[model samples]
Target: MSRQHTSGDLRADRRYAYAEACLAEGDAAGAAEMAEQALDLAPRFAPAWLLLGRAREALHAAGGRETDLQGALRAYANALDLDPEDVLGSRLRLAQLGVGDALAAISPAYVRALFDGYAARFERHLVGELGYRGPTMLCASIDALAGAGRRFARVLDLGCGTGLMGATLEGRFDRLAGVDLSPAMLAKAEARGLYHRLVAGELTGFLAGEAAASADLVVAADVFIYLGDLRPALAAIARVLGPDGLAAFTVQSHDGAGIVIGPDGRYAHADAEVLAAADAAGLSLRSLTPAAIRRQNGLGVPGRIAVLSPGLA
Candidate 1:
């Protein structure tokens, strides 16, 4: 799950590769068979188990068979047991299927593993393919609120994947610091030379470790989608932000009252919940604008970009 050799058995590895190919080719039955063969040889291989689960999930989606769904659940459960850290995102799959805790927060390991693997082609794919405009949108929002020629003494970029957000805020901040869980992503960000400080750590933990009232602006562009509950992050942001500091972020939004885990393994938060979290965290919600965060399957994904400041009331 950590991008290491997943299977020690050569035959099992081959079978797993074939299973992946089969799934890619839309041969769910063949994929399942191949994954089963791999698991028979290496029962403890988490990747194979995950593949089996995916194959079964595909089958269940097509056939609507309870048996297939149950099989998928078992396979994912086994994978989760083998790797509790959920680097492969077994928990997300379970939640997506509505079989487990629907509001479960994505595992940090999963996010780290995901971005680490994507770090190489991340900007190209996300911005070019998916049409991601989170960084640009956030920067515009900040500039609009701060007015012309406004500059920040200190800025924090939460989940600063490949320094995209830092790059967007280039001339606006005197000092730019970024934090990400993936070392690979941090390496990519470091290569950009946009950030003054680059930290490899979880966003919440990094925020908590910073001195209180230290940051003039804290930004988390498209970062909250991986986190179902925003209260903790909001509180940490509030603690680290100066009295007049602003916290800007974005999230995949839903019409529901709270949160929902989508099939794509991302969390979508409702406007009500966002406001509630801001209130509870002692932050004032300055704005929540509906925007298209990215494109998925040729359509824009519904999301909200929000800005918050220390509460005056």
Candidate 2:
């Protein structure tokens, strides 16, 4: 049974219904064509345009024509241009295509959109399909971080996807909060009942909203991979921590960007760059260990987990 949405828009909606039907049947070319036709009638329908682009892209991936990439990029860009309210995630798909300078032009917005879109099935695809052990492995590692002041009064799990980290910290803390950009992900987290509250927001902005000197333990597992540069998020994390606070997070160790890193569009960071970012944030690294990278596309890559504290701590 194919899932369906109940939006009554008549022509455009019916076109979308047909396109979706074709898509569910695995006819990417037919779906793309129908979606393009719908978009022609409703040029402002950003989702339709974006879906057309995706269908075309999927077709391209399955031995479709080389020209499909360019067409998909154009359709996605057009959708984004029409409605910049984050209604469509063509930006990230554009970034993944690597046809042009789409990455730099849309990496941040694309990542945000990508995460939001995947928020619903984020864990299922990542953990069940890709064998993502980031949270499972990270939770195990956090046990070792319990040193002299391991007891946390207030804990914050940044990018607490589906509350996996919070589950690990469950009973270990009195007050807990989670923040991420996707409500669907938060919905899953909320279902876990581990976090006291889950907020829909990005890292930098959410960190800004948090009161200073509140969180004693802040952990972000597999969150930093989407980020190309780490200085901004690091600074944000430093700002929200107590003087003796601790933060544990993960990072990918590859050379470039635009997917193909860990098979989940993960962007690996360099040691020098991470060190420099930490230094710039005035946070000293207590320990950085090269942990087992999560499996992606049925393979594993190198990764690291680090515990950091305020310079004064």
Candidate 3:
């Protein structure tokens, strides 16, 4: 996912750069023109196609022109054809336009590339600018349900971005292991010296590789937003967790009957669907409490913190 991108022609690259700047400045028409010029020079350049799609999408959003929307979809589909792994997030863009599957919109390549680019200032921006407290709220829920003094022999942190959740439980666990998709974020977490083991992998795959009943606690703070379905992850968690062990996680919640992709591209799972997934996974819920996971635009984002144990439903 950490690969170089270029048009192979300086003029095309320049046009692409200018197109990016134009899009950032809200000049959709200029951006579209520049992106078209770039594509004309380098028809095989996927980034140019992606930029063209974004420019057209902005134009459609402003004017509600069906032609612009159709053009955007065609450009996105072309981008995806050029880069099947979707490192440029063409699938997400298509999903935003309601032209693709929402459940599979997010690609690991895209997430890895995104966090790799944002890793340097991720903590500062997320904690300082976004006012994110997902780790803190998740830890609080764990303590409330499992007891503050409960110490675990082994703990697993899923989507452990920069070791935030691991840092919160530093002294409570004898051994701490973390799994994340972004290598850059894993490097940051490694530098913190909190996790005894750090693996760069997807959450469910990591959990599947672990021994059954190996962990006493598993935590996923602000990670479920990327996953539209929870049944697979919950089933894997139940397999790895000991009978007495517990799993604590948080989800962006909505009032709908099922999961929905929010305008921000994050998945928001309804409370009933979450409970149903846990039940199907043979995990009994200890707590499902409303929480404010973070602040978006200076207002609290609605979420839910769930604590569960491997038990009869």
Candidate 4:
């Protein structure tokens, strides 16, 4: 069931709407004032709190006011207290501001909402503007390691946004199945008729539901960034893979010891952490090659393409 807002009062809702409009119009002070008024009327209105937080953040950015930053933090904290499921993504905001420890994992609701809104322009912006070539890069890595004339019986595409990877591996696999969080993205993938099945759910959850040793190949192109800890997902992949099955994925890399949430709200994993996670999951690392996953802000984002197979006793 969807979460219900605390603001049952119609007047409070109207004030919140006006605050949102003011924020959109670049009037941060006005938005903050209106949001405060809305909150006064309906103290538990989480949306109003979120708006107030955003307005304070804007004010802080504009003038570097410590009080504004503190206000933003308090407002975000209040929203999280009212809605711990993080429907407003207060945790993400807090992490981005360096005010708290990064979340163990990004909220699935946030990822779904983000992709649902970005589905229409995802391909264009990612491929054209950001120079995203994750799918192509993963396929190239596969060809280099697996050699020519290689094929798989069944393939699972995790986080298969718009079937870009499916399109790349169209004839290479006998059966193709896709899993993603966003129905809108899945709809676009379905329109291409590239996958035999498409499931709208979290990656690990979908993998757990599949029959054991069912997939010969599992691929997650540019998807691991949303996942902070790789152990659970890798364990699920290990469980679902055939004896000779291979799991391939890309992850943004960091020089530190563990995963860290970047300012962009994406997680970057250290090489050590990834290797340790794979080893713990009883998977043998076949390859871990550095590559430029995509371009962000006109610069190449450093990442790794990893291939793992079932470990031998």
lDDT of 3 by residue, 237-260 (tens): 999999899999999999877888
**Best-fitting candidate, scored by lDDT:** 3
Candidate 3 similarity to native, TM-score: 0.97
List the global CA lDDT of all models.
0.90, 0.74, 0.91, 0.89
Better of 1 and 4 by TM-score: 1
Model 2 stretches astray by more than 4 angstroms: 1-12, 17-28, 58-67, 99-126, 145-149, 255-263
How many angstroms is residue 199 displaced in model 1 relative to the true structure, after the best TM-score fit? 0.7
Ranked by TM-score, the better of candidates 2 and 4 is 4
Give the clashing residue pairs of candidate 3, or none.
none
Clashes of each: 0, 0, 0, 0
Weakest 10 consecutive residues, lDDT, candidate 1?
A: 1-10
Q: What TM-score would each prediction reach against the true structure?
A: 0.97, 0.78, 0.97, 0.89
Q: Candidate 2, residue 151: CA error in Å?
A: 1.6
Model 1 — TM-score against the truth?
0.97
Which one wins by lDDT: 3 or 4?
3
Using lDDT as the yardstick, the better of models 1 and 3 is: 3
Model 2 vs. true fold: TM = 0.78
1-313: candidate 4 lDDT, tens digit per residue = 0233648888888888888899999999999999999999999988789889999999999999999999999999999888777766788888888877674547887788778888999999999999998988888878777885479999999999999999989889999999999999999999998799999999999998999999999999989999888999999999999998888999999887788888677999999988999998999888899998789888898899998899833
